[model samples]
Target: MCCLRRKKNKQGQYQELISVVPSVPGHSAPVIPVSQGFCARHGEIPFSLPPRCVPQNTAVLRDAERQEKEKEGAMKVDAQRDILAHRGSLSVGSWYPVGSVLTGLYSMTPLSEVVAPPLGMATRLCFSVEYRHSSEQLVVSLLRLSNLLPRFHSNMTLVELRLLPDDRRPRQAKARGTGPDPEFNDCLIFQVSAVCVLRSTLSVCVLSVEKDGKRHAVGRVLFPLEGELGQAGRVLWRDLDPEEETQCSELGDVQISLSYSSSLQRLSLVVLGARGLQLLTDAGVCVQVSLQIHTQMVKTKRSCVVEGEQDPIFNYRMTFKLRPQHLDDACLRFELQHPNDNRSEPPALLGVLVLGPFMYARGLQLQHWMDMINKAQEPVRMWHRLGRAI
Candidate 1:
């Protein structure tokens, strides 16, 4: 019998060959007849091989089939490259099958079609100012405030006027109506010099009073008293800028009248009233006044307690003995306190105010001090804003 085996040729290629061997030892094997058929792709077969060797032509056929597959694969790759090259220019409709409905369509709405929440109303104040050259006094007449938005069910609104850089003493008018529009035919007069009329600005603040006596600054306007506006008296309407939440959280105002008598070597402070104070508890509130000289507590006094009144009227007076030489280092501290039921426990502090020289105070506090020193023996009354406790 004979078997077919594969061997490598000198050209490094594998070829199929038939190996002849005897079935019995030392005996010649019988030879079979070779096939005379010829392959259509690989040509004719050798005549020396047996008929069983005819299957060897399958290896050649596999090689020819593999070549044809490689050619077809190369053609397919080139076609895909051409499609990808022009992909950007192709329309979306061409990518999908014809008559197929497109799903999940996305569209954006125009800005004009979008609805937003309506804003609050704009507040306007109508007023006029006239500076008299002969009297050196600037007179401001507040006619009315229109379009005032009510924060609470019952709103009481007031107007505060201040002359900047020259005078910081706040002149407040009585609060008016609970409606959106309130009329205030109030007039405020401030003594000014020629330079003050040209350089100073008039600040008008509109405040809303709540039932709890908490005051919120709704809006404010700063009008420059320069050029034609300060020279000629004309009625003008100005829009008020809305106050921020930080400004509204300020601890109210305290009306204090100060007078320093050099002859008596004494300083008298009258706490007439306080408005817009914030009360956190049902306990009564009192004002604790302390006199500090060179950071040392010299004397301390407390006002009478008022129950259930956030805007309390104390009308209390306290006197401090002070020398003229120590006036520069003297400071007065005021604290709003809630008295505790137990006398042993300390009172709860709400707000504080300090009035001293330029090094210790600024704004209205410093201005108050300078005014007291400038107009000695004369009572200088002003409304001072309170701040949070230390």
Candidate 2:
């Protein structure tokens, strides 16, 4: 009888194989015949590369596919490059005289990201200067505010912008409404310099913000903001015909006045939100702020004091300084906080609220300042060399 040999399995089950006895000393090897069980586990063996993962042929296919993908990517890049080339290089970082900046650089809104509707909304801007400069310079480009144009798509407008030392004219541009920010649809240059102070102002006439007029958290011309910020708004308290929260533009010269009344006081501004007034203290630090809520009837006779949560309009005035890095560029941030409202709203007005680098309030003219920087105390090197040659 033929000997049916079996192979041992870990599970104690036997796998069959053919056993052959040879006459030669070492020819007793068993050969398995071609049968159903012989090739049962076709794909069970483990291998390094993936199945059909051919290195040479698959690599060639992969490389070709990769090349095709790269070519497609190149087309997209080329299209963008062509678009950029069509639009000449933009001048952005050049420093220029404070006076040369557009009158109203729109302080546009980041309304786009939070709500999608207010994204690219145009914002107003204004800067107040109270000093002068010894030397200053001006830098400008044709496309300063191009990034914020998608929403309004309006060519830059110098809406009610202001600059320093105007003829001291009776023009109500300075104290009245303000200009827009650079991010607004307008590309207006709002810079000024003078004997007393240089202030820059910017404004955007229209913006594409989401929300109906009167109750709109920031209204139509909403400026975007971040973190905690302070905002001041004119409120009609005690006697109300249209009592609900109304925007500054809706109030239309309703007499809103903010001042640092206390002598040597750190009166930081706080936005009176729905829950309560949030004091914008120094960034990243918890500061104990002392506040005094009073009435400034400068713009109106309906004077009402500010308190805490119970009253939104008559809330105590709070003030704190944000670290330089966290200081917002807006004069007035959101006055109220709606849970859904991200603090990305810019101030209603644009331009530097705090007198900055070249303003007279801070120092002096930008051009003279640049002169001081680029000017040489000694003779020019080229002139000195010529003199030595002589």
lDDT scores for all predictions? 0.74, 0.27
**Candidate 1 residue-wise lDDT, 275-344, digit = tens:** 7788888888899999998868999999999884778898999999999987789989999888999999
Best by TM-score: 1
Question: What TM-score would candidate 1 get against the native?
Answer: 0.41
TM-scores for every candidate against the unseen true structure: 0.41, 0.18
The reply for model 2, stretches above 4 Å from the true place, is 1-139, 142-390
Angstrom error of the Cα, residue 88, model 2: value is 28
Q: Give me the candidate number with maximum lDDT.
A: 1
> In model 1, what is the error at residue 337, expressed in angstroms?
0.6
